[model samples]
Each structure stands twice: as structure tokens, then as C-alpha cells.
Target: MLTPDRIDSEASALTGAVRELARRTHFPVSFGGFVDGGNAHISAIHGSRTRSLDGLNVRVMRGLGGRVMAEIRPRATPDYGAARHITHDYDRHILGEGISTLLAVPVIVGGRVRGLLYGGAWASANVGEVVMKPAFQVADALATELRVRDEVERRLATLDGATAPASGALGPASPRAQGGAATPTEPHPSLPAAHREELRESYAELRTIAAAITDPDVRARLAHVEQRLAALSGDDDTAQLTSSVSLSPRETDVLACAAIGATNAQIAAQLSLREGTVKAYLSSAMAKLDASTRHAAVTKARRSGLLP
Candidate 1:
């Protein structure tokens, strides 16, 4: 779960990513914003000659990033000073930064626009596909990071709520008392079994998304969540380190898909395999776990800390 410290870390990590994008793409300036209260809050900037854009709040469809967010697609202009398609709400900031051209990419998570990434050039120039590809890649990575953070925050909220006293009642057992660990608090012993199942499902979703993600940075962050989920599930350090629980890679992939409630056909379509192949893999996974049904297989995998 994301504490204040973890939030700071996420912000710092995102800032670094923005800076690296600017440096690698050879853009004179780069900036990024996260969606907050339906507004794009400028959170990270790099290579800016002026502070006009610092902490800018771009309303949806009011500026470049906002337009991208509203459209849920990348947009670019060779000449920001004369672009006729966009609202010029931030022209002053653009001119102040000496940027004549810019590109904006929407950061989408779960099919919703969650943030935006921007790259700027001082001279009027076309932001070609070569540059646009990397810009969109950065946006995708940021979107994944934001999703991971949100999941962490949700988990933390659950834990906090569970530990809170009810009408002056006492909290759950401490980490040291419950699991003999001084750090990395384990899941509360009194938490209901249903809630644990939910956590495992969330963990499995994270793993499936991580497996599908192509961005290295996003995958790394998701890996951390996987480890945390293992700990929360009472899986030991050795299991976390080994991680696979003797499941073959294909078996793991099949079970990961099943864990997310994907049908055999849907999984086949996703993995570009025949439905029979999907069924065979799932059957193999079930046999390996000695389970008789798909749900049972998922349950066994989660209990073994293999799905998450």
C-alpha cells in the first residue's frame, strides 16, 4: 500500500521518467500531468527555461494536454503558436518557455485517461513517428505506474479500516505478534476469508497486467506489488523468492488468465492460441495443482502464492 513515503517515491520515480524521456528524445523540454478532480495537474517538468508551466492546472479540453486527455489519443502540432485545432489557454506559458512545437500523449489506464505526457521543441518542427512512439511509450509506462499506486493505496485503505477500532475496541494483532516479523507487516489474522480471496484476486490481476505490460519500469513496480501480495497471503520469503511454485510458465500463464475470470475462448483470443490449446494448458495447470475445476485450480494457485 502507498503511504506518504511511497507516494513521494512514486512522484520521484515519475519525475525521473519524464526527465529521461526529455533527455532521450532530444526534446528541449518535457512535462507531464496526472488527472486530479477532472483537471490535468502538471506534476513533473524537465528542461524548462521558464516556470510558467510549473504546477499548471489544465482543465479538460482547455489546452494541449487537456485535449489529449479528452480525446484519449496522442496529439501534436508543428507550430503551437499557430495551431488552430486547440484552445490556446496556455499560450502564454508556451511562448514563455520558447516552445514553438509540442506533442501530447494521453496516459490511459483501464481504458480511461489518467494522465498526459508532453514534449516540446523550441523551433517549429514536426514531431515524427520516431519521437511519437517513445512519447507514447512513456505515457503507457506512467499509466501503469499510476494504476499500481492506486492498487497499493486501496490495499492500504483496507488494512487501515480493518485495524481501526470499532467503538473504542482494540486493533488487530501487531506484526511482531502475528508473524514474528519486525518489518513489512503481515495480513491481519482476524481478516475474513472472503477478504483474503479478494486480495488474492487483485494480486492475480496485477500479475496478469504485469505479464502483458511491455514497459520495463512498470513491470518492475508491479513486481514489487507481487512480492507484497505474497507476504500478505502468508507465503514465506522462500516462496516469494522462488515465486513460481513449480508451475510451468505456460501453466502459470493459463492460470493467470483464469484468475482474472477470463473465459477459455477469451484467453485464447488474448494469447493468440487456439481454444483447444487454451483448454489443454488450463487442464495441465489443474492437473499440476491436483484440482478438479477451474475455480479450484485458481484457489489452489492463490493459496500456493503462484498466481499472484
Candidate 2:
């Protein structure tokens, strides 16, 4: 249930996680880097002496980390100076780290390489399963976290595209009338078909991410996002055009919580009410809005401008 800010905070925590992994696995040095365009930018480093690799850019397929990006998997080298397979473009930087073994694991999310997790050792040791296994696990967890972040970004974009227009625009106005005027077509009163489809796809992805989240608090946060998206997709003629939908204060409060995917128990705890009371309020709101489900009620409420 982390907000955008919290999600970012969690992503940044990968650096610390990398440091811990390096220490635990007998690798004295570790760093985390992210890919941007055609280059990898080193963002976090620990146990480096020269600082040469700090903030350095490794071109795609040109170095150890670069090869990882190209292959979209984990790679390692027992001797950086003697590795003949990878290009030696980063030899200077790698040598500067004073490590004999190096390992790089690509952070793949949603089918694209997003970043890298790296580990290195000061002694001459082979970077085998012992080192690579833990690094890969870290990379896998990071990929899921990155996927959540990616979904959040896409969700925001979808919302912006669907909501950015004249207030109550509701597609086109149709025409006029048939007398001597023009005939009016039915107004959409919701997002355009293309935009709606985009939102639906984004919503589905968010749900997938939510289901993948193991943290209860984080999962709840994602659930709330799903509810908001569901509310955005609700459409109605009376609610959109005339704004006749109405609910009591308690009803509105309960519906707002439900809109964010809050369960009845959670809503009760948040509102300091009994579970039965929360359910009663939700039922009243749904009845008033003529909605068959909690999600429908939220959508109807939002279309009527009753909730943001």
C-alpha cells in the first residue's frame, strides 16, 4: 500500500539490499545500477576504492554489466582482466574496483531490462552459484518491485489521458435535433473507447501487481488504486449530465473507503464504526446510487461528481 513516494523509497532500498548481500556472500563489494536509454548508470556502490565506476555509464553490450543487459540474465567472470568473451570497454573502471571476480544480474520487469544488481570480490575466487544465486534472488525481488512502479506510472498516464478535457465534456455533443435542427446521438458520458480500453488494460495490470505483492500493507495500497480505476470507469447519463445522484454523509464516507478497495472490516476500523454499520452505510449508498455492487456505487458516485 505504498504511495508513489513510498514505492520510490522501496526501489531505492535496493542499494542497501545489495550491500547486505555482498557482505553475507563473502563478496566485499556490491553496487546497484539502472539502465537508461543505451547506457547503464551506476547509482549505488559499496566497498569500492577508486570510485571510478560511480555514476559511470556502461554502453549496451560493451562491458560486463552491459552484456547482462543484452542477454537479459545473470552473468559472471572469475577474472575481469582475463575474460575474453566480454568487451574490455569497462576494463579501466572494473580494474579500478580491485576485484578479481564480478557478477551482474539484469533487473527485468514487464519483459524489459530495467536495471542491474552487481557483486564483486577482492580475492581471486570464482563467482559461482554461491555468489550468483543470492544476487539473482535480489534481482528477482527487485523486478517485482519495479513492476509495481511501472504499473503505477502507467495508471497515472491512463488517468491523465482519460480525465484531461473540458469538465463534463462527455465526448461530443452529438448534433442538434431532427425538426429543422439536427439529430443528437447518444453521448458517451465516459472515456472514449480507446482511452477506456487503455484504462481497462492498466487496471488489469495493477490487479496483477497487487496479487503479486506479498506485503499486506502494500497489497492494500494497490487495492485502493484498483478501486479508483474502477470508479473512473463508471458511466451514467443522469449522473454525468444532471448530477442527480445523492448520498448521506455516512454513505459518502463509506463509499469513498470502498472506492479504494477497502474491505468492510478495514473500512470499519478506519472509520471507527462497527463492521455491520459500515456494511449498512455501503448498502444505503449503493441503493441510493442504484448500483448493484460496491464498485458500481463508487463509479456512479464519481460520475455524479460526488467523489474525487
Question: Per-residue lDDT for 93 in model 1?
Answer: 86
What clash pairs does model 1 have? none
Off by over 4 Å in 2: 1-14, 165-208, 214-224, 230-308
- Per model, state how many residue pairs clash: 0, 5
Model 1: residue 181 alpha-carbon error in angstroms: 4.7
Across 127-148, the per-residue lDDT of candidate 1 in tens digits comes to 8889988877777767767776
Highest TM-score scorer: 1
Candidate 2, residue 201: CA error in Å? 7.2
Return the clash pairs for model 2, or none.
1-217, 1-218, 1-221, 177-182, 224-260
TM-score of each: 0.64, 0.61
Give per-model CA RMSD: 6.4, 9.9
Most lDDT-accurate candidate: 1
